[model samples]
Every structure is written in C-alpha cells, then in structure tokens.
Target: MNKVVCLAALAAALGLSACVSSSIPAPEVTMSKVTRGMSQNEVIARVGPPDRMRGQNGNECYQYALGKYGDVPFAVYFRRAAVVASERASCNLSITRATAGPGIVWQASDYAATRR
Candidate 1:
C-alpha cells in the first residue's frame, strides 16, 4: 500500500509540473513580419488588427501592443497609399498606461531591395 501511494504521489507531481509549464503562452511578437506597401487588409491578414490606430501627418500608423511583457510597440508607418517604415519601441507599462520611446526604424526600401 505504501508503494502504491508513493507511485501515485509521483505521478501527481509530474502531472502538475507539466500543466504549469504548458500554461504560459509563447511570446506573441516573435512571429510579427511587416513590410512596406502592404495594404491595411494585408496587415490585418498577417498580424490581425492593431491594438489601436492613430494618425500622423495625414498618414495612418498602426500600433500593435504587446501586453504587459515589456515587449516593444510595433509601429507601421504608412504614407499616401503605401507603407514607408516600421519601428519597434521597447516599452513597459506603469500603473495606468504604456511608456515607450524612440526605437529602431526599418525602412521599406531596405526590405524591398533584398531578394528572398
């Protein structure tokens, strides 16, 4: 009886550990791939709708927020009818809102001129 109880306890411990490990979702931003001139529809299809949208200089900027993980804010810059640049600012949230600063900006030309 003691041996059976020990085996059951071991099984229970292993099961609990597995459940804990699997409960944390993988990071969401790793798969984000954006390019210039991709239409609003294309962006939606690839990354889903932005967490929020705002305007800048007559262009629309889509802000994709990564919740609470100190992940960066992905900003896609669109001008006229095409995407011009993409930027990501490493950010963290304080009590009520997110705080981010200037981040690396990747230009569309850089991505377009590359093959494969």
Candidate 2:
C-alpha cells in the first residue's frame, strides 16, 4: 500500500543519512600503520583492503586513495609476498619491463606507453 511504500522510503533515507554522517579516518593515519617487510595479511589487517592492485611477474602493488577526501594516490609494493616499499604515488605494472641486467631499473617517466 501507499503507507508501506512511504515508510520504506523514509527508512531508506534515514539509513543513507546515517552512512553519510559517519567519519572516514585520514588516509595518512591509516597508511602510517603499515610498514615495510609486513606480510600481505598484516598489511590488510592494519590498513584495511586496498582500493586497487597491480602486479607483474611475481611482484605486486596495492594502491589506495590518499588525501583528506581520498583523491590522491598511494601505493605499497610487495616482492616475494612481503612488503618492499610504500610511496605516496600510483604505479601501473605495464610501465615496467624486465631487464637483462643485474638489478631492477626503473625508468624516469611517470606516464608512458605500456611495455609488452
């Protein structure tokens, strides 16, 4: 009936308003709790789930939105299932390629065509 529909709509609006009123913790505060050498599980437990993930070969990078409104980029790198580095930047795995040299070499470009 019309009464039931109105009641349902009011309840839905109230629920949504409650969700919007809740506060989100600052990204820096959360990211600070994560540290290098931590396992993936530990990282998740400390900072909750990542917003996105990228990987190439055996390496993985978890990306999260930074800033007060979650508009900036942040990334945590993992190698061999362990945390290797954390940076206030985003990375696309395709930007890197395996070199036939001794150690890993990162190109000096922030944006580039993907390597095949």
Question: Considering every candidate listed, which one attains the maximal lDDT?
Answer: 2
Give model 1's TM-score versus the native structure: 0.46
lDDT on C-alpha atoms for all candidate structures: 0.53, 0.69
Residue-level lDDT of model 2, residues 1-116, one tens digit each, is 99999999999999999999987887778778878889888988888798886654425678888766788788887776678778788855643222111244444643222334
lDDT of 1 by residue, 25-49 (tens): 2335523467877776777787778
How many steric clashes does model 2 contain?
A: 0
Error of 2 at 113 (Å): 17
TM-score on alpha carbons, each prediction: 0.46, 0.59
